[model samples]
Target: MCIIFFQFKPHSASAYRFILAANRDEYYSRPTKPADFWENDCNILSGYLVADFLTEEADGLTYLKKVSSEGHLYNGFNLITAEFNNTKGDTMCYYGNKSGQEPKTLEPGIYGLSNSLLETPWKKLVYGKKLFTDTVKQCNELSQESLVEELINMLNNEEFQLPAPDIEEQGQDFIRPMLKEISALFVRTSSYGTRTNTVILVDAKGHVTFTERTMLNPDANQWKVSSFQFELEI
Candidate 1:
């Protein structure tokens, strides 16, 4: 599971700015130019170590200091555009240009949402390094419309199969207590033939009680039929 924790802090000017600190396990969607990059929707820089400045006695201290002295490490309120070398009349990899300003060599591959880093100095402090890519690929099953037809046909012919007697009895005993703890539920349906992976959370009372994964065959109506259901704890 890829989980992101968004820590928000209020801004001083009443504008829509926020202080964002996230730790995520999933790959990010890469951003291309001409389209404004959505930080929440895409990944940060390809290679950024937030823990580099954390400890005084760490291993990469000298190297990080050298990189920091070369240029500004963070920018606010704008996306990071590639930096150029004006004197050399050429583009440089380690440097980045901000709002058409002169490029500065900070380090290679450190990026984030514009203006997000300034308020949170802790963001620059990286304690470890990891190799990762933030790219989102288009779904491969998009063009095959026949997948939906197959699902509809399967649902129409299949019979409902209940869980084993022992599991069913166990469910009866545990399901009620689990249902009280669910927080929310979501029902998602993709286009005809498209696959759907959905999760439903139900809180019976105050605690999480029931969780389920319902796989369904896509059809025009709700009778699309349930392919499978599993009980879970929150």
Candidate 2:
């Protein structure tokens, strides 16, 4: 399971500016691929990683310190997009719902996204919706610790399940089993589950904070965490 939920700031000069929190759930046996800034001209660059003061051009634009996720290590169909200040004053962004099978304009507003239904699972969507909405509503300041605590709680909401759609209906399934709850932002399928929980925060001042918490030894028993802070060079 892979989820990407962010905030949208339409109409404003920094409109579509976003703060993203996402998780990747996959089988441990699936040789996991990592994230990095665009490297060689290979297909893997689609889900790549970012480096400090590093820059690479892809998707028709140059990104400084750009990184991506290839879903699972072996292979998967997923690419995440977060708008950033690429060129000091560039004002372009992805405004439609291409992640879905069809073309649809997500009405301007605040929303979250999950791997199940890319457009914020309309099933258990409210849970996610509320999670983000309350976050924006209540929290006066968004820090790495606050984001971690908030997201960890959200990911551990086993009871939170979107009403599953019918089989053969051509829709993704939203079934997160209620197992021995361990971590705040992870799940386990005997051997496979959320390998990492990431929080990316971009404030109104062009400062960027990226934090990643990964499971050590592929076991949800513990987390090895790291954070990076930098200014988005315009």
Candidate 3:
């Protein structure tokens, strides 16, 4: 399961307007690529395909709501969409088919999400949000480099949370062990584990800094780090 922790303060007078850290957990043996700007669209940066359906006329929340209407076509996913506007500040929204909740705009605040849903209160999510809150509080004290380093370190945390009682009672015999193993922010199993960690910071001046750390060779523990910075056109 993947996890994300983010704070949105678009109207803040501080150095940063938004901060996010995420981990993509998957089988180590699965084919993967590092984060980069898309070849077809230089304006978009991601490890995966940039959704071409998102038109310039429509904001992220609108597009997400359209997707939600067809949510049955895809597997369960927790999707968060944000649109940052210089004139209008920023808007963020969350939609998840698993929770059966309607798409709704989110106010400026810190939040955590995992496989289950947004703010599901999974132990790891709770712990991660607390860590994220603490990091955000010290943003003014840390340099941009230090902030990124701290967020990366936060994602690398390996402390495991005890499985919730409901999960233990409800999970199947074969699934309980797997759930326990994945309770850590940094999941490390024999085959499946956290393969990538990404940190994104968007400053109040519309400057964006994106950093990604990806495991290149899981067996040898080899990894690659990439960073990019650009000013938003807006």
Candidate 4:
């Protein structure tokens, strides 16, 4: 299943002036669910806020409702408005902003997923790094205040390297169940003497995803991927 948690804070006096921020999650078995697609967006729930006030009855569609909120969703993403509704009536409301702005590219950090009140825990997704799964687990195991402080510290840590994969060619007539698993793959292209990198992360299930590249040195003549890092969640 997919779930989205958001925080909103007002930035101005206008009725529509608010900020929207959120994180999305999908089950491993349900990779195509809503959360996976809307991963890092601030505008995922705007339609509901402008149309109607969400209530106990609006379970299947997104709408806006006034309730206690956790994070300042209105201030987090510099959003104007958002929507919330229980389209499926599972007691889980779908919320997002009206104007769509992708937050994944803005910065690398950890995002928390929460219910309407923003006090309860749902799940968390880590962005721009290979240790996402582990980080999430650690956060879930910490005290509320400790989790917040630790999470911020983790996000603030200097960007590290992405590891390289082991590549080999097999003989034309040979077949091998005896192949080594790819540890990691660091893909980079250099042109104009400047390097651009894209980190492809592969989970244990063999699913591959991408991450933003962090340059190793500021004083270096040109930027290049320093390394690729990998870790098993188990």
RMSD of 2: 7.1
Provide the overall lDDT of each model, using Cα atoms, as 2-decimal numbers.
0.23, 0.50, 0.83, 0.25
The residue-by-residue lDDT of candidate 4 on 113-223, one tens digit each, is 322212223111122222333443453355433433443334333332222111123211221121111111111112111122222222222222322222333222433
Clashes of 1: 32
Clashing pairs in 3: none
> What lDDT, from 0 to 1, does candidate 1 have?
0.23
Name the lDDT of candidate 3: 0.83
Encode model 2's per-residue lDDT on 97-192: one tens digit a residue. Answer: 233342223444566555434454444455556776676554446544676578656655555342344211333232434323212234566776
lDDT rank, highest first? 3, 2, 4, 1
Deviation in angstroms for 65 in model 1? 34
Please rank every candidate by TM-score, starting with the best.
Answer: 3, 2, 4, 1
lDDT string for model 1 (7-31, tens) is: 1212212211111112211111222
Better of 1 and 4 by TM-score: 4
- Model 1 weakest lDDT span, ten residues long: 127-136
lDDT of 3 by residue, 149-220 (tens): 999999989898886554455446744777777778988888888899999999988899999999986642
Greater-lDDT candidate between 1 and 2: 2
Task: Let me know the TM-score candidate 4 reaches against the reference structure.
Answer: 0.22
